[model samples]
Target: MRYFGGLVHAIGSFARDRSGNFAVLFGMVASVLALGVGFAVNVSQLYNAKSSLQGVVDAAVTSTARDLTTGVIKEADANKSVQAFLDANSRAGILSADQIVLDKLTVDRTANTVQADVHVDLGLYFPIFSVGDMKRVAASTTAVYSDKTIEVAMMLDVTGSMAANWWAKTDKIGDLRTAASGAVEDLLDNNLDPKNPRVRVAIVPYAEAVNTGGLASTVFVEARYGSNVPPPIDAPVSVSLTLAPDKCATERKDKDGYADYSPDGPNTPRLDNDGKTYLAKVNRDDHMKTCPKPELIPLTADKQKLLDTITDFRADGVTAGGIAAQWGYYMLSPSWRSAIADAALGAGPANFDKKKVAKVAILMTDGQFNTAFAGGRGAPRSQNAGQKSRSNAEGICSNMKRDGIEIFTIGFDLDDPSMTMTERDQAKSVLKNCSTADTSSLKHYYEAATGTELAAAFDEITENIEKLAIQR
Candidate 1:
């Protein structure tokens, strides 16, 4: 009976020995629950921060990129801009402290764009179960930059008619000077490089003729003299001092309607002295700060000299502008520039036609060329292009002006002297069409009878040029 009582006590003691199993089971279940809650809460917060950071970076980079294209901001400025943007967003609580960092930033000036990579770090927020502080990282960003120069040319008319109020306005010549001076100042103000020799100018002065009359005339005449006068339809031939290998003297008409003959030297009718006024340079303080060397030789061929020549002009002669137009074309033609480079007659040939540099020409006149007056008596130009000295000055200006040269034309004071607008419009049309682009690149034609309108015409032309420089 006693042994049976001992067995019952042992069974009761065994049932109470479950302490180790309960502890193990409770620990496992607690660990699993904490892990699931921590993952769900912390991971979701990290993901939300990452998305917000990406949105902020996208906005910042895009804003900076646009500024680069206008030449306002540079590639070097891009990084600073991006950093500033990020800082602003962070201050707004769009980002966490010390959580944002620049992963990488690259600036490429050659391509004009800046590229940036950004990183964001997230910290654990919920502490329901303090397993550990978690780190969540996300990457985002990009920004871009741009810089470009415009091409420009100044086409000016230095024709004689521009000097006198030949068209009835305040001296067309004065108007031209006013307009061109204004243009240069505007260009300088707008950042054009006169020294860079990039922005160039070509002055074309047309009259009854283009007095290659100075040193050029001296040389050309000595080499070129005609015996059998070209027909009245052709450009009148210009001769030096007339003295045929077998003839007597060279006779020229004076403004007073008298003919004097010269056989050479100071004795006969020297082509050097005309009965009317002579060509002289007048570079007053008003001119564009007299250009440098080779370009400042108006004692022969300058804006002033050309203007003076225009002033000295006589109405006795008919216009044979084609020859003058041809010469102007030659001035801006690559082939001509190359050929004349060695001729080196008027100005410094260097700046005139540097390799790869652009060429330009301006043709201005008031007449349609009905006659060509050779310096001699009755040896008039034939207004005829086929047989004469190529009476097609308009055609010459047209053909060559189209290639690469920028051309402009001004028809002053004539009310359809050619009997129709077609003749006048032809050259002007060619000029306008051959301008650099479409609008600012073409030529301008102005008609002025009163001084105010003529001056206004000049102002209008200059304004167009200024507009081109600014736009370009």
Candidate 2:
């Protein structure tokens, strides 16, 4: 009986010895397996989410960059479109686009790029997993392909009043030259263009009267001595050779010695936005023959001619922007390429050639147009008519735009005019219709009350140009 009891006890002992050890081993194995499964689920979900949404970001960004500077679309509204695309398509692939959360989207105006940030919260199934959450952050590729040259035309105001401290602390003439040349250097120094043509610049200095170069000096000079056209006209100032006999004189002997050929003539001509006069019966299309050599002197060139030309600029005469605007139009007119084949500015025509180029003019002025020939070759003396001149100049600039020459007109430091407010307002009205550039690009037209503002304005414009140059 005793022997039988000992056998049973040994069997019980063996069973008890292994029970606790088996339980411990099973727990350890289960915990390890649980963690492995959890991490696998999290990693797999995150990887799938990133792969799917990365495509979404790329597509959205590429689409957004297309019309960045075209003005075809407004920015605020465009950004909303981008945001919606990213957010709506956030959840898209195996893990689901919804799983990938959109954080924010931004469109940079000056940089011309679209960027988006997002993250995915990976959900894994494992109750005993050590960490409950896993996340992955991602960013979209920056998309704005900038690789084009910037084109610039510096149109400066060289009026007589520019000699006066008309623009705040600075005089008009010096101020214009300083501002203009500075803007030029900014473009060249930064090398705005990443493409072959590079940023090309032209300096157009003008006043009440532009320097009329004779054909002997510049090809733009028309046959003067033989032709009936008199020397360039000057601004209308109160002089001894007046148009009216003065309210004080009634002798009516035509004492001023200037011919009165019916001052304003029969009708007011209707010049369209492109300087195309529907009423002038005379075709001014030949005006392209008037583009002067412009004394190349490129500031961007390694030589110093451009700097010399700018320094030599003198402020004289009244403000006659009409001639300035007209020539600006002609310089960019493709028709002139043939006319200037041998002229100093012959290359100008090619540079502005229509078939293979985009033409833009930047015209800056501080005064209104007050002198236009009406009664035929003399000062307008009857009643002091300034509105007509302003209107005509406005018409010419506007017409230039219609004619396909992109114009950027700057109204810089305009002072109170000698004429009524109506005349001043009439002149101000011209700038609104200036420029063939898209409304979006025209935002670059800057008004500087102070010199610092002028520099900043220039910087802003160049920055924008750099961004959009990709498509030049």
Candidate 1 lDDT by residue in tens digits, 393-440: 434444654454454455556563434776555434443443334454
The local distance difference test score of each candidate is: 0.43, 0.50
For every candidate, C-alpha RMSD to the true structure in Å: 16.2, 14.8
Cα-lDDT of candidate 2? 0.50
Off by over 4 Å in 1: 1-170, 184-195, 213-219, 222-318, 336-358, 371-391, 416-472
> Residues 357-449, candidate 2, lDDT per residue (tens digit)?
444677777667665332222444562424434544555566655654556666665444444676556556666555444555446355665
TM-score between model 2 and native = 0.53
